[model samples]
Target chain A: MSNNTAIKIENLSKMYRLGQIGTGSLGQDLNRFYAKLRGKEDPYSIIGQTNDRTSEAESDFVWALKGINFEVKQGEVLGVIGKNGAGKSTLLKLISQITAPTTGAIKAKGRIASLLEVGTGMHPEMTARENIFLNGAILGMTKKEIKAKFDEIIDFAGCQMYIETPIKRFSSGMRVRLGFAVAAFLEPEILIVDEVLAVGDAEFQKKAIGKMKEVSNGGERTVLFVSHNMGSIKTLCNRAIVLEHGKLVYDGTAEDGVSYYLNNQNNASEKNLLQRTDRIGNGKLKFTGIKMLNKKNKSVNEIIAGDPVKFNIDYKTNCDIDVNKLLFGITFWDQHENKILGYSTDEMGITFSNLKNEGYFTLNIPCFGLRGGTYNIKLIATVGGTKMENMLDNIENAYSMTVLPGDFWQTGKANRSGNMALLKGSISQHNE
Target chain B: MNKDEDWDIILKPKRNLLDINLKQIYQYRDLLFLFVKRDIITTYKQTILGPIWFFVQPILTMVIYVFIFGKVAKISTDDIPQPLFYISGIIMWNYFSSCFSLTANTFTGNAGIFGKVFFPRLIVPLSQITSNLIKFCIQFILFLIVFFYYLNSNAITPSYLIVLLPVLILIIAVLGLGLGLIFSSLTTKYKDLKFLMQFGIQLLMYATPVIYPLSTIPAQYQFWFKLNPLTHVIETFKTAFLGSGQFSLTGLLYSCIFTTFTLIIGVIIFNKTEQNFMDTV
Candidate 1:
């Protein structure tokens, strides 16, 4: 309610009905009607659980978002970070009015345009020129406004030659660029962009981040951005909020928010990894536990970039089958779910023939080459050299490890703001 | 609470059922215009005949009606030329049916767009009605050409009541739009209505005086036809242009009242549905 505040959300919650969904029983409709007739609240909505996807529903309803409250100042670029199904998108959808909340309200200043997707409402049969107008109008731009900036949008997208051509013929990257170009020209006071940059190529992503900065840096526009990419969040957002299980868990500077999310979040690491039922495969061999160890082999989940580390994956075999050419692999994915580093015992031509019923695979690295960030570790155990490589166990997002910035090259300075991988090489001056 | 008044927008869990945002729809008039343009243009994108299909469609339907209902069934055309009588009814009924069916699919058909963006949801159905009107006008020209041919032979006479043509069209549009909105809202939750809508429109067409003149029906059943708002529209349209068929001020007045109520109720349900239809859809 202050003069500088652009948006204020008060205890906003969205409850969704689970199981036997959308069939819309007449009995329930009548129940809801009777409740309303008695001047009472919705009967089914009053009792529900939190928005946790990992657990079975205790009731027929689940709160997709619950008791979420935050305030964004004008000209502030706020990044919303959370794991999938953690209410990040539900919050954005609520703020953008794509769907209404079940309880509470959001009061905001000025016009709000959300790019929950790029080229939303664009017709494939329409020419690029036509889609620009259509997409622009869908994003709340007038025809005259689109016409005035038509050339700029085309130039920005770098598709002037294909402006007359239908966009269906364009490559996926070209379509993204064209869509982002029109959206960028929309000068709404508040902009909600939800992971639209994940589709475009690298150069276009850079241009999009720059445009977003320019829009917010003008001291007039407010932006709410949601993405799985933490690098963009740290660079583009001045402040950030983290939602976990539909609750506002962290709110502060973008740096602290990203660290808080990475440090406190892990899928099966907190509980006994052996008890996790989300794993998939033939289950002939199952991963019992995965641990990140320091040089002394002590368990540690956080390490510096240049530190020596080992990934110890404990497994147990189910049957007495002879294990021939068994492979143990561990893949490290960055925050964006891009595979940054992966190593398999078979890659080094060192395959075990007969594995014990219970054993552990240790992948040792003399120097951890990944830059400072959180990486998810996926464990896969397979038996090769016999009848088309049988996968025994595959556990995705089994563990999350935090990598701190360090002197990977021993240069006393850190390599930041670049690719996620680090390398060390020797250079000597030579006269040629 | 007073301080909250300054905010540009306030989103709440429940809004007034009657809180139809006409101002917002007006503000997004350009979107409506573009949607109308998109519907009309993309419909004939790769078709060979293009807009000529607009003419071919009604002409074909007229010929069929003339064959089945006129020659085979012996349905009366009130002594007017078979083509003119049927064409007049065909054009008017086509406009109503197209408006109803197209607008009825507004929520389900545009779910992809509706889910991603936030605009006045009313603009979509408004655009459907608008674009169908454009198609109707093109088909109306076809009707006029046939009307001129009949007029030269003294088979038909134009009345001053022809001035009410715009009013009659307005009633048909409102009736279709209203019922379409109501059905569209229902289809989002109960998909069974979608199937019902397909055959329901066909059956409703028979209940109105489309293939046969109002005189062909007995007086007892004619009252039931009058209960259908479209019957008055079709009757008034025929009486004004073709110089035969029933046209009553009271009947037109009854349609006006019926259309106004349907529109109000349709908008109420539509406004309610658009808010959270995405969740169900």
Candidate 2:
């Protein structure tokens, strides 16, 4: 590893056995122990050797993270972007020494502190003052050092009045603020943050991002940040790593990685629509597939800020069911679980008369004025007030679709205020 | 990389083993002191009696033992006054029991904090032991009051063995901590062990000669009594203060050897468990 490289991860892989859960048995423990003692590779190393699909899929290990290699230099701020279950948290946990990696090695320099979650080490009965020290100790800070910085931490958290009050009395925001304040002030050589900034308000978030920038710019520390906000990723990160299905899909400049992630998200939604049955659910009545197309009947993942789009849902009913009283609704939620828009057949004044066989339905809406961002479409099918199938289908990132710069609104800013863009109109003044 | 500039002191945790960094632990000693202070201060902050609970608990337990075992059961205190004898045993026993009980639940109790941060896990149990020692100190003073009152009345005389009180207390603390850690590690995997721990500690007090004098046990049962390391610790305490119980140097040696051995094993198991206990716990 180069001297400038703050972190070096080599062939890092993490495999968790599928269905062979509960920390494994004593026999399996001994088997693994003896295998390590004999210098043999993990008995479960052979990826597909234990694959037995018929017998409840035994003897197979799921690679939560696979053969990942990367280097982070001093003062570098790297963003780790991945979908849920993509092993982002696992990677941080391994680096922070919360858990050991099952395979490979990670070499890192400096005192590393990770804010994996907020209010992690806070004791409810302990006062804010006591918890500050307790939390400092848990983060590996010495008492003398914490004492030296105590006033600063309390001031930053803005909870000095309640220093002697138990933390249980603090609001969630206060708890998060205090937690972030401590972690940020720890001043470690390397900091790893995992989506914890999303906990606080926008003002605190801006402050935290600013602090992260300061920490990295100081030229002595490095940072690894993970967030789903592409805008923040683009603004905060110098480099970025993209993970897809437990694999390193891309690693490069922040712009390129963000673009790659957006493009991959586009493809994933398309692929998931094609293979919708594989999505986990009751599996009795299923949303077999879904497709969104433009007026030209072309399958388009991208659309203008205001344009016409058509949604087609292909579903199968296990048994004959009533169609007249059936309800088909679709809700669009942003990546952060923010609901942007929703519509149902009842609200649209469209209803099916009678249906006995499995089929497809198409809903078309014109002049959809959704702003640029990724949005998930949740399709719910209910009959006789009993819900059957509900699936959140990804329709390209609605918001991330590029909007040309010169319309009525200025395009220099990356994000526009409010929920969605509104048509702009102006009344002209005439002088005679 | 310049080796001299690099401050990489943390070692990767050894697999399938409990590893401790004594140096890093020492480096964080100030944090430990703060944690101990936090424990002591926050424990009494909202309570009515506050620090007096520390004194009241042992005194009340000694009074109850005096009522049930001395007056009701007519158990002999080996010709020693009931209050002084019971107070001595109660103080020492309460300290050991509290240490073991608290240490046994260390991992479970602190899982929330442990899951979030990376620190020497040993600091938690160490702080608990230290904090409990504060309580023990208060109760020990109360025990001293009873001892002096009896001495002033010419009812009992302390022996030269009283010099061994501190050493005996150290042995008892280590024994409690060791066994507590072992049980705590086990409880992470089997939650049922926690229930057993509460009942088991109470049952162990009966086996240890806390309420009854060691001399009261029949001669044939002496070997079995000696098998209990805590028995020797209690007997040593009684002999040191009340000056009536038997004091065998060989028994003290045996207890010391057992305490050391249990502690070593406890440290090993505890180190191993701390690594991935977050998962199981």
Among these predictions, the greatest TM-score belongs to 1
- TM-scores of the candidates are 0.84, 0.79
Reference-based lDDT, each prediction: 0.86, 0.75
Q: Provide i-RMS per model in Å.
A: 1.6, 3.0
Cα lDDT, model 1, residue A405: 62
Model 2 clash count equals: 7
Consecutive 10-residue window with the lowest summed lDDT within model 2 chain B: B4-13
Show pairs that collide, candidate 1: none
Candidate with maximal DockQ: 1
RMSD of each: 7.1, 8.6
Q: Which residue window of length 10 is worst by lDDT in model 1 chain B?
A: B1-10
